[model samples]
Target: MSLHADALTTLRDWEAPDDEQEALRRRYLTHLERHPDGMLRAGRPDHVTASTLVLDAAGTSVLLTLHAKSGRWFQVGGHTEPEDATLAGAALREALEETGIARADLALDPVPLLLDAHHVPFCGPGENVHHLDVMFVAHAAASAAPSISEESLDLAWWPVDGLPDAELAPFVARALARRRHAGQAGSASGAAGSSSDGGGSSRAAADQPSR
Candidate 1:
């Protein structure tokens, strides 16, 4: 299936974790239904964007980028490209591109972890655009090292409990909760196995631009 169709299917089938999220899900669905080009950056006032928060294999820290345009820390991600087959694929592509973390070192979750809608004043000339962002989570191998991309002013792994941006706390919490839940489920099914080791060490790469 095409990326647009895949996004529609994913959003339609997703079970939102809360009433607010459910509302946003419905809004996203409505936008896609109304605008066939909704997944593209050229879609205008509102478009779907994909992003991924990279966690250490140990789930104790997350990778964040310092956005050049916004001068704010955020997960690695950006606009969807036509080559992307699915929303998750788009997110993974962004993560790899922005973090410089090899695919072998990142284990991305196919399921989206959250959704966010926010205004981007720099997205267009003389107009503000809203990004309907679909967020995913990935776990980096213990030995994984991320290099900075041009899209970021800096790249760093911050402890989950010590995020540079307070606003990201909830998202990190949600991802960790999901991880624990999955682990428990695997254990209950007698399929538990060791996850890739994610070292808790914090490190930052030099500066770069925005999404």
Candidate 2:
């Protein structure tokens, strides 16, 4: 199936992280149902954007880009391309391009760790846009270094424990929390079944914590 169709299918079946997220998911689904080109950049008011938070091998540090436009430190991600097979593919492609990481050295989780719906005012010429961002988690070897892309003002690694107060994107905290929970769950499950248990942990962590 096409990536757009695949996205629609994924959202249709996805167990959203909370009532708020579920409501947003339903809105995204409804938008897709009404607009066939909803996932594209030209989709106008709304579109799908994929982002990946790249962790070091130890999962303690995350690579962040100082987005040239927004001047904010955020994960690597962008709009979906026509050739992208899935949302995860789009996210990984963005990550590799933004971070200069070889696909061979990156380990990406296919299932998204977070879904964020937010607005971007400058995406178009005097047009307000809404992004239904699908967020994924990935890991690169500690030895791997990231190169700065023209899209970013700079690139650097930040410890999850000591992220700076103001530079982080809003989704960063939520994604990191989910990643930590998954890690802890896997550790508690022990090495023999850790892999399988880790999979379950992702689903459980996908649920947003009660506010």
Q: Number of the top candidate by lDDT? A: 1
Worst 10 residues of 1 by lDDT: 202-211
Assess candidate 1 and give its TM-score to the true structure: 0.89
Residue-by-residue lDDT tens digits, candidate 1, 1-211: 9999999999988889999999999999999999999999899789999999899978899999999999999999999999999998999999999999999999888788999999899997537689999999888999898999998899999999899989999999999988887766545434322233332322111001001
Give the whole-model CA lDDT for all candidates, comma-separated: 0.88, 0.79
- Residues 1-211, candidate 2, lDDT per residue (tens digit)? 9998888877776777778878888888888899888889888888888999888877677898888988778888999999998887899999999999887888777777677788888788546798888888887976787899989899999987777544354556666676688666655555545566654433322223221
Compute each candidate's TM-score over C-alphas.
Answer: 0.89, 0.82
Each candidate: RMSD: 8.0, 5.5
Over all chains combined, what TM-score does candidate 2 have?
0.82
